[model samples]
Target: MTETALSFELPANLAVEKFIAKLSKKTVIELALQQYSLKTFYDSFDWRLYNANLICEFNQSKNGSSLSLISSLNGKVITSTELDDVPAFASEFKDNVMANKLAMLLEVRALLPLTTVDLQIYKINILNREQKTVARLMIEQYDQLKTRLSIQAIKGYDKAYIRLSALLQDEFSLKTAEKGLLIRALKRQGRKPNDYSSKLNLKLTPEMTAAEAVRVIYKTLLKTIKLNEQGTIEDIDSEFLHDFRVAVRKTRSALSQIKAIFPDEHNAYYKEYFAWLGTITGLTRDMDVYLLSFDDYKASLPESMREDLNPLHEFLLFKQAHAQKELANHLKSKKYLTTLHDWELYLKRFIEKEDLQKNTHISIKELADSRIWKVYQQVLNDGAAINEDSPAELLHDLRKTCKKLRYLMEFFQSLYPPEKIKTLIKALKGFQEVLGNFQDYEVQEISLKQFSEEMMQQGTPSNTFLAMGVLVQGLEERRGKARHDFTGRFNDFKVPLNQKVFKFLFAHKSKGE
Candidate 1:
């Protein structure tokens, strides 16, 4: 049988030299010590690596630096690469197994430095009868505050490992450690792996009032916006702005959909401000999308003509930077700051019973069912009315309706049967994708035409305009395809099983109405 590695915690007052002397007396041991200038753990802001059952650590020494990807479950190194310095993105790593693995897991997200610690290592060799090393031990002290001992078994030397483990346990009365030094260090700083994510996962109960549940949802969304604000202003990556806007949209959708859950005055103030927030942030986000998809944009054209789009790329970067600066200024403005602060205070403050709205006092389940069912019926009605020649406005309106329904389902996901609600959501998502793509393509095509006129006014080369025209034509084709696919996608969503699940889960209660 293969022996898995083991780690043990030493008592706070135990002296390392004294422990080594005691161990040497029991068994012949060879020791080597080394110190690292620094050891840091890194992951995406969303904790992508940690969620994938992996952790990345970088170690700096006098000679150079090294990065290793380790399995969090067993504390085994999967791959290691030597680097001159730390990289901000996975694509910067040298071509190797680690680079390939990281690229797959961390698409566009930048690696963020999470925790750093001063590390010292004491390596010990367990010898067999002939004085040949059979097993290895690593004693690590982190930040001079805690120490850990790890036992790694050598293949064909399980007996030695078992004997050593038994001796440590029986003679020293050492207890096994539940986690590694890196994890413990993170805990010391009050941070946990997998603590931050962009997705919404709320825990709500049916017994709560509609007003209470909405408050909880808004609070979470507000936290998300605050968390991503700095990154967005710094333009770290497109996702920060993307996540921030999503939270804002969700807040707006809640205010609009869950009508009468808040007083009219409160709802009107927030809805107007959030709409303003969305408008100011839209241009930068649009440029981000275009730039992120530029590679694919190039691929869609002929090889010889692709270079013609280079000017467009440069133009986009300039525009994006200008828009980003404007957005940063807006975010720092007194109006923006005060609005968010007021919204936060409103969500957090106490409310008198007499001031609550009609829906506020009803159970959350009733509100969820009523809102979701009403939207679901509207979706079916609107989708069934579209045909080969329906105006684009109909699909656009349906898209917004579908989004509102999606938000409601997600907000109230916890109050229903997990698998059943998930099934309905899955169906809705497929339908939404067709509508979303259809709308995005149409919007992009229109924007490109306007951009070409602007470029012409600025004396951009005529060939760039030709290239853009080709891009616009391509977008129109894709948009047409999506519109064509809508019928089948909508039909799939309207299938008997999906209809059954939606009705079974949401349509049963109409008490809020």
Candidate 2:
């Protein structure tokens, strides 16, 4: 049976024992005490549960560990499970509601411990003349500084609960609790829900100069770098390095794509460093992708063959660990520190510099229009030149070009009509996804072949080589499908309506009427 619970904040002056003594005079009060150690709350990096009005808590005691998924609104436990150990990924859980919900909510992200607090719990039963419990009270004290009270009515005892609540309110001045203990604990430590996001949320106006806009983008990237540093250092999850690499890519893309907004020499200098950053982190991130998709890759093969793929998993783990060590060392090195310091100083200097360059002073709209038009025309020219028999390198080059155009569109999207730009970007993204898959499959196949050769030199089993061959074949088939779908995807993107929207928004016009 389900019960309704009402929560309150205990007054600062009232002790739990004293409150119970006052209540015992009127009715029988039974007290039960429980203590929990190593109580931790878990959430996605973006706080998906807190935003959904859910609280997920992990409690560890002498017996074992247990996880509870509770509704923060009504303090009802949606589910609870006794966990042998905490899972590294949501997908690690076998088919269960908690796993299903978590997988859907935290796709490609791991649950990280947000905060830890010890809980001192008191359960009070209010009994009547017949020694029947009608009302329940739970008082939770977190870390000795925070206290919360919850009053619950037993099934079929609404009127009895009302009288008990009235008496408790009269004895103690109770206030409605607006936040759960987890949230209050987080606030006590100076953190808030949904405090971090990787997306760029800058607000730019048309009047802002090209240089100013570029600085805004750089600052956002800088913040992303600072935010991911802890995760990278601790190796909490693969996403930390993934996000770090992406931020670097965006920074490099901004410098390269938005040319002349910064000095050409300065841009070249930083582009080299960012490119180096990407190169060093590539192996780790690639291994991360392959490991994350390991199960899917195995499922594609016959069940009997899946067991033989274990060696490949071991190799990936070893290489990933080695690559991560290299990355961590580089991140902790003087060069990395100096590069960031120099980059920040350069941005500040450029933004405040009085003698701006010619292109820096140009209105962002004109600049965006000119660049977008040039890139779009280039894409048309290059895409039309490709046929079914073209070399793989041709498609690779075209993919890079598409990425540049897409980034340009995203960076300057706000300067155009919202609906028009949204439609155009949606089309562009669909086309880019096709190209991206094609390129990725090709790269993976090539990497697998290279690894196979290395494993053979290390005296790996022939069965392992056979499994690698199977994976390579699967990737080739996927690549072929992507290639086959490209023409249709491009046609959808390059339709006349989208072309017209592009022209209306960014096409260059002559001086004459």
Candidate 3:
């Protein structure tokens, strides 16, 4: 492959004022290149100096004790995170950015883990017009590229953070597919390849791993039961259900994440474990998201104008109950337990192997990032469609894929800066929430409308039918408003998205070469 000269300089004395100056002047890239980082993609931070047409990073140092911000002109302030804490910072940025009310200081001087300095910078134009500035860019000193980025050298504990932190933090890096890492461990243990381990890398984790996938099935079943309530259970809003179902999907992802690297035949439960859960949850989860947005659709309209709303609501509610029931029975079945036991046995076996010692130094986060992007590209290539027949349903499915991507990104977050990770996560979450809200209202509207009509047909008291009808109409109004809100958000993100996330994931960079 061919290469080009792009500069990325780091702060030898790194200070806030100088850092601010570096950002304001757009010199961070040169600084980044000085250390030779090979980061191919960047965030809004990379654009701080000047939105370069293209960004390439090279110099990569191992993980550090404190946070490292690379102004390396890759175009974003990529924070090197050793700690997995970013949502809190991301939330702060979101709040601050949305407020748009500049704090007396927009610079990072006040931020933690870094100090202030002489913040000044100059612009460099070497693109477009015979080599000219196409736009009056922000006059800043952020270097697009930066110092080398590397891992495995940090003075950490005995094992990979995965197992080491387990005893300390009571948290285990969530796993989806365990086979890949296991393969790596086996190699370290000098295991020879056999029919048992061949072609394991090509395997796909079923819709849900048998062991962990049940979390989703059970959650979906609970949602179904809550919705069924026969008027007895108090179900939370669809948003709550939406969250639960999504979490369940992640558990499925965890199963897949941990297994993608291992050989399948040796793993008895590999093929059968996730298939059943995936089928049931796939259908129920789709409906759950749609039902949540159903009410939002009705709510969008004015109280006086929802003639079509009544029937739409009725049809959806009736249909959803069926989906919910399927989920409930799948969870209640003894088959689920049988699958879980098998899966557990496999994990226990894999973990106890002599090969397990090799994985002690392994980091699953790295493995996850590479595979996650491959998965995203695969879906993007095969193509997914969203339309009226089941727009909400299709969208929820899309979000599940998005969740896997999100989780993978989160795991290897130290590979990038907290800010960069947060920004991407925030944008993706925004997209999900917009569609998510719309789907929520749509579902509620569907259920209540059907309930009222049924009561009316049965010659029930006017109070029961009228009360439910009023609720349905109220829901339609909410739906109309939600529709507007969802559309507005969805449209606003159309252009910003291509630059923001699509490129972020697809960009290929050698491991901090």
Q: Which runs of model 3 end up more than 4 angstroms from their true locations?
A: 1-247, 254-259, 263-334, 351-366, 374-397, 411-415, 453-459, 473-487, 491-506, 510-513
- Winner on lDDT between 1 and 2 is 1
- Candidate 3's TM-score reads 0.37
TM-score of each: 0.95, 0.90, 0.37
**Model 3 weakest 10-residue run by lDDT:** 195-204
Per-residue lDDT of 1-513 in model 2, one digit per residue for the tens?
546477787777877667778778877888855555567998877677777888888988776888878888887888788896778677798649878887777777778888888867778888877888888888776655557788888888888889877776776667778777786778888998878876666666778888788788898888888788778766778888878888888888888888877667888999999899889888889999998889988998877888889888999999889988888888888988899889988888877774457678877777778888888988888888888888878788888888888878888888888899889989988998999999999999999999898888888889988988898999999999999998888889889998999899988541111
lDDT of 1 by residue, 1-513 (tens): 223479887788876667888999999898855555678898888989998888899988786789888888887788889887778777788857877899899988888889888877788988878988888888877655567888989898878899999988999888899876667778888988767799998999999988888888999999999999999998877888999999999999998888887788889989999999999999999999998889998999878789998888888999999999999999999999999998887887735444667887889999899889989999999999999899999999999999999999999999999999988889899999999999999888988888888888888888888888899999999999999999999999999888888888888877544
What's the lDDT for candidate 2? 0.82
lDDT of 3: 0.41
The C-alpha lDDT values of all candidates are 0.87, 0.82, 0.41
Model 1, which residues run further than 4 Å from truth? Answer: 1-4, 350-354, 457-463, 511-513
Supply candidate 1's per-residue lDDT for 251: 95
**What would the per-residue lDDT of candidate 3 be over residues 1-513, giving only the tens digit for each residue?**
111112223333454345435433432122222221222221122122112222212122333122233333332433333332222122244344421321222221112211111212332221232442222112222232122111111123223322322321232121222222112333544642231210111222233232322233233333432332221111222332343344444445655654533344533354445555556656555555455555555565555544445554555566667777666676657886566556555555554452323222234433444565675554343223443344555555655666666665544444555576667667656766766656656666675665557656756555445545666666677666655565455445444564456457435531331
Least accurate 10 contiguous residues by lDDT in model 2: 504-513
